[model samples]
Target chain A: MMRSDDLVMLYSGPDQVDYAYLSPETAGVYQNKHGSFQHRSLVGKAFGTRIRASNSDGWVDALAPTPELWASAVRHRTQIVHQLDAAVVCFELGVRRSSVCAEAGTGSGAMTGALSRSCGSVHTYEFNEARATAAQGEFERNGLTNVTVRHCDVCEEGFRDLDVDSVDAVFLDLPEPWRALPHALRVAKPGARIATYSPCVEQVHRTRDALSTCLDLRTLEVRQRDFVVKDVLLETGLAPPAKRRKDYQNEDDAPRRYANCAFLAWF
Target chain B: MVDAGDEVVLWTSQGTYLFAEAKVGSTFRWTKRERVRVDALIGAPFGATFEIRGGALVRAAPRGAATTVEDDGERRDNRWLADDNRAQRLDADDLKRMRRDGASGEAIIDALVAGSDTFAHKTQFAQQKWLRRKQNKYLPWVRVLEPRAATIAAAYFSRGNLLPHRVVLRPDTVAQLVARANARDGAKIITVDHSGGVALAAILERIEPSGKALVPHRGPFEALRRCNLTDLDRRVVCFSLDETPPPQGDSLVLVAKTDPIANLDALLPLLCPSAPIVVYSDTVEPLAAAYAHLQASGLATAILLSETWLRDFQVLPNRTHPTMSMSATGGYLLSATKIVVADAA
Candidate 1:
């Protein structure tokens, strides 16, 4: 197990965008759109094998891998996890360093990057033989001995491990996570945390229903909105209040005001 | 910062004077010729007059470069301050000269900030830093004003039309380029690309794939095109701004400028009072300022500036204008029966 300073997972838009803030000095992990992480830096930064989440979409892009472990793992393809979702999951779940985790439907090794960075070990499952093979290579390249990819459908081949009730976290990004809820319940400890990502509401409902028996799911959804801000002059003498009031009350609650709403959000 | 609807005159060292409403809560700079633009004849301790017009500025006939010609008589250097005249008395001639001297509205703001500083040294340093930074950041934007204006005009004229002449992008963005595009008849949809030109090309490809994606390469001929785009069964014509003058036939519609402030300024002369000028923006400040200016200037009887533009200041709106519509939140249309007739004709 690799022990490092505060493990950071920063969310960037996608790909190793050249103009991003991740250039060296700033070391952590960058997630691609396909949910894969890659270790990147300005030539003078980083040590050991570069670990990145692998995906079918060429989501992982690492410059030069110095470590033998990273070179080997570079060939794998798995569904990598996005930095945003990963950070949210890690924080909300209160994951501890060196904790054992379970992940299902490893598309490209994105979530694996997160688990590998924060936990002691991860047992990831992938049904696709080709994907599993790719993931295996990535594990070797990153020199990650802790994360082991098993080539079996988590739903069918029940988890067989040294300990059943000691897993720290469980994450599912499959098409239908509800199907894996039963399997998740069987393997999870009493209060182990679980997280899932689904685009559609129908799937959210199904997963919520399926996990209801085993997990006491408190939080439901995460929504993000990006907006543009405009400054409006507050008519006349209200300048003092407008300038002093840092936190604005909703216009419905105010008499004199200036306002505009411009933003788009995604769930 | 000056509020919207506040009438102010700007002077410059250029021949033409400018009389423009503040479009944003911007500050002025202490660069060369800025004094003529903002402070007017105020700091000319030697006493001087100035004029303003069309946002440009110039100094009026000068009495003398030196007031009290005592070489060592401790004459207060007027060059370090504004002349005695206030912002209200600035006229068109001063604005014209200021424009000729390349003065900007931003200069007026820098002057105000400089004037507020308690320490003279600190004020000079701050103004200098601001001018340097602003020059570096806004040069690219100022250079493309012409083309940007044309693109906005085209989009504005195409409002309520189909997806061919008009296209929606970033349905998720506050500007709602897609929402407005979808709502308009004949509106076409396009995805956002990292490069602005690439995004425009993607739209053109969907409308006409005949190697016309090289429209920019088509030179002056780019504006004149045999358009065959249709949406919701309405006929549409697609052309680039550099190539096409405003559609000069009867019943034709024209888009003005992508820059919201300039766009409104152009529309003020063309639009009729009581006509709805729907405005939208990814941020509300520029649009609000424009709306307030239009209303206060007696240009429009009623103006509707949407509350949508105040989204995020970071994501600069594409400044796309929809035709035949006051911008819907600054991206909507500025409508008037006579204006439409005039533009179409």
Candidate 2:
């Protein structure tokens, strides 16, 4: 059962997600396109729990918050990392429950949300103070105690200020990750897995040049699966239109700032 | 350090992998001349390399395993080469005799190259390609990797005769499927795996120390043992679908080698409203039926059916291109969010 202060991901559609913080004191109607429901009514309901909207006549399911959902629903303080890139990065980095990870230039705290859930603990460094403070507050609100948001330029000084010298994995979402490779390698454990997300191909070449000794480097561009399966029925209310798969991407059409491509290298 | 009887994937330097147990008295045969006893690797750490020295397995020195030696040999170009089936001078019996005498993989490769009528005359690019293809077969050195889900799935994929529908449930695709399921901590994930246990292992790796997964498979789930997962009793419960009903879950996954229509009918009821559902199949016929059923029934919305094929690029200084061989298919996946519809009754 869900308790007050537990982070809840309320869903009205597959892609439509909204955050709801439950408290008995702030008893009011929670509103979204799905419907409106009383905040107090959700206090004792089970998770993956459904309740009818008192006003919109539609319904929403109360589900547990995951990194994928958070990536979709979190307020876009900056263009967040796409879930596809995040998934590939998480896997290629080999992060697990026992790993310690570090990130640079925490843009919008989006990728950090993924890294936090994937590994044991994350020490995220952001160059911007405002973004750093904002992400810290957001993590606290979501009750994520395993993340630490610090205001530091990792490219400038390295991951030394946080007092952690070595980590199991490292991720760089900065514009110029070549400068931080030496610093990242310094703190990364021997045989640590490292991945970088850059928007351009030239950055991949420059990043590859920084580690000339590494062998058998692989570069992958994981496109979102868009070729719609043929011959599936589509009623008017169920699906938007049967025209094209690009139509589904209209919701996320806003220009994204970080994570255009991924460069993964094993050391 | 791995102990005795631990399962490990013996990874070849040339990119072939197989699952083997570090048993006390068993022998792992990579090739005729590379049957090394497994007892020496009993306590060696994972990622350690083992070589066959006098029929005994022993830790071998790292073979530079570094950068691919880029040698653009300019001796001869292959413009005049013709494929009339007489390109190799070594006949079948000669090759058989060389193998019977226990020639090393490298020695065999050298003999083959020397005996070839057109090998030295081929272009640098063609020569490299030929070397790479031969290396996959003749390389004898092995690296011991932990037999995790990814490794096991890769090893199974390398050893073929697989159902096309099951290929998408391989390593990279499994990661994407888990994301599509919206798997999280403490959430119940119901899986119907027909691809051995790739889907289950992918989810378990990410949501460890938290969630519970119930797998309804038909057999003994013998493949799950290959993953060598610890704490399996608490995290997963296995049963035959004919025996009992599974608890309702937040998400559903169906990767069926047979038709997925039957599995979806049985598992869809356990998913709550707004739960994400992912169905994988190599053919669109079965998934089309399953997709239409969910759509016409008003049981799911925001439904998207799609498939993806990944191409890997080799990044080298002067010669970068897609690898010579690429997998043509990753299969189809039908995904949707289950929603509640008011009953007309």
Give each model a TM-score. Answer: 0.29, 0.81
Write one digit per residue (lDDT tens) for candidate 2, span B261-334: 77777878888766889888877777778877887876675566666556676665556666778777667778
lDDT of 2 at B65: 35
Per-residue lDDT over B238-259 for candidate 1, one digit per residue giving the tens place of the 0 to 100 score? 4333543432211111122245
lDDT tens digits by residue: candidate 2, A104-153:
87878878888887789998988888889999999999877899888888
> Pick by lDDT: which candidate is best?
2
Query: Among all windows of ten consecutive residues in candidate 2 chain A, which has the lowest summed lDDT?
Result: A252-261
Candidate with best TM-score: 2
TM-score for chain A, candidates 1 onward in order: 0.57, 0.83
Q: Per-residue lDDT of A133-243 in model 1, one digit per residue for the tens?
A: 887876665566778898888777756562667686787777777787777767777546687766555565566557544412332332232222234555467345644
Model 1, C-alpha of A194: deviation from truth (Å): 1.6
Which stretches of model 2 miss by more than 4 angstroms? A1-17, A20-63, A161-166, A211-216, A227-267, B32-34, B63-139, B162-168, B239-246, B258-261, B272-274, B296-302, B338-345
